[model samples]
Target: MSIVTGSLFALALAASPATPAPPKPATTTLAPGVTLLRGEFVPGRQPDGNTIVVDAPQGLIVFDTGRHAEHAQAVLDLAKARGKPIAAIVNSHWHLDHVGGNVKLRAAFPEAKVYATGAIDAALGGFLASYRRQLAQAIDMAASDPKKQDGYRAELALIDAGERLQPTERIAASGPRDIAGRRVELQVVAPAVTGGDLTLFDTVTRTLFAGDLVTLPAPLFDTACPARWSAALAALDASDFKRLVPGHGAPMPHEQLSQYRRAFDGLLACAASKRAAAECTAGWIADAGALIPDAEQAFARTLVDYYVGNVLRGDASRLEANCAAPNDLH
Candidate 1:
């Protein structure tokens, strides 16, 4: 419930059903032992980042757990069906959509150690703290309406569950790691998505988990440092990953990743130019082309416009603030 819980809750609640039942997120077996809990982004609501479950030698390793209850349930369901306990968790970043289900999953798998960057510690007292206040106000306003109050309260509950969201095991560097007997390469990038992002690369499958560095419906700039983000993409481009798993949308190929990088660079360049915000949005949609489906094009444009005006061009302050110090994840 702790989605992008600021004005989005108010916006989503105005139109969303009392208890919306989103369709089941698509789950695909990307490789011999890798399963994807694909994230869902409703046109009018907050989105859930994708989750990757690896059948590691030690046990099931869950990569980003999704936002809502059902999304998290999908992950748990996969674990149950596999007849294996969850032995570890690898979060992409600290965004609620990506890590909100940490508490739930941890409860289910009491011994599962979470592997992520140390960024969430600061977010507890910074960005998420500010958002907590927003949710509280929204909750107060909706107190007169039971349905609306329920939605806002649910989001607040996750924010208030502070320590539960922090990583149990901090990923402080970028390199090859043998987790639960599974040898996987880990990529840590900062001031890009959240304060830090923990991406996973499994040579066994030639798959790179790009986290928020690559997303659909356009690049979401909620906590991104545009310049650093470009460098992050460049790093991904430099890699020889055959299959790339993004934090959102479907898994893509190396060529698709290259296409995404070009569009990302062009979007940033366009935003930095003297062109109007509309021009930047249009260029993003056009540049993204096939990566974004026809149904998602409108939303993609909205996201581009939001990032351009608010993050890229709105103020020097946002850029400076978002350029948070990188975590000691070398």
Candidate 2:
């Protein structure tokens, strides 16, 4: 399926109470000094494609964990390669992908400390509440449709298998600190993508581990306030990072991040214009043919799908809204 179709399907699944449980976490190396670790509970893909790893001199640090325990084990393997124990595990946010490996990481590296923006802890708390509500409602939806009901049963099974991961710690974004032997600075910029979203900067490498704050094909509004997201991107634009890493997609220079920001702003403007003209469609996919061009069709459609089915519909708003810095969400 197309990225747009896939995203749309994910939305439908997320709301149906029968969405397949995510896969056990896994690991994959991204680039030198970077690893994309998977989470434990996410299904095949989407929403649960978390990337966790350590950086240079940053010693043992984690970016994010996939949705399952196995993914955490994958991280342990990577850490083992370093020939040293993990010093810290930082959750990008409260999302299952980013935080799923928390418990396992703690188990593997008993001495490692977990850190995250206070906002992430808050975000997780809200997600759990909302997720429970969504499941309850999804149960009813599934009951009405046999196919959906079967899926719901599968989800129930996954949950019963202890697939979901929740945060049990709290951390503060206490600015810059000495990670391993490296001196780095942490900044909680703006919550464009998610409420408590932020990034870490390595002054030495001039690299910024931007969470979901800077995404490719434009920032995913799957869980965002467009206007607020716009402001957040602008804030990022005003920042000083050169190299950047995103929660999804590969890493690139700041210019690439800018392109995403522009695309996001442009789309929001289009949405706002449509809203002002009183010609807005009831669905995100309705206007893709006209507003999104083919050259960048995949991304445009992805944005449309995420905005319409996820953001506009208020699917994960409260989770994003209540996230804070120095909070534990894994």
lDDT of every predicted structure (CA atoms)? 0.82, 0.54
- TM-scores for every candidate against the unseen true structure: 0.94, 0.68
Candidate 2's error at 53, in angstroms? Answer: 2.4
lDDT of 1 by residue, 242-296 (tens): 8999988889999888999999999888888899999888988888789998988
Using TM-score as the measure, which candidate wins? 1
Index of the highest-lDDT prediction:
1
What is the C-alpha local distance difference test score of candidate 2? 0.54
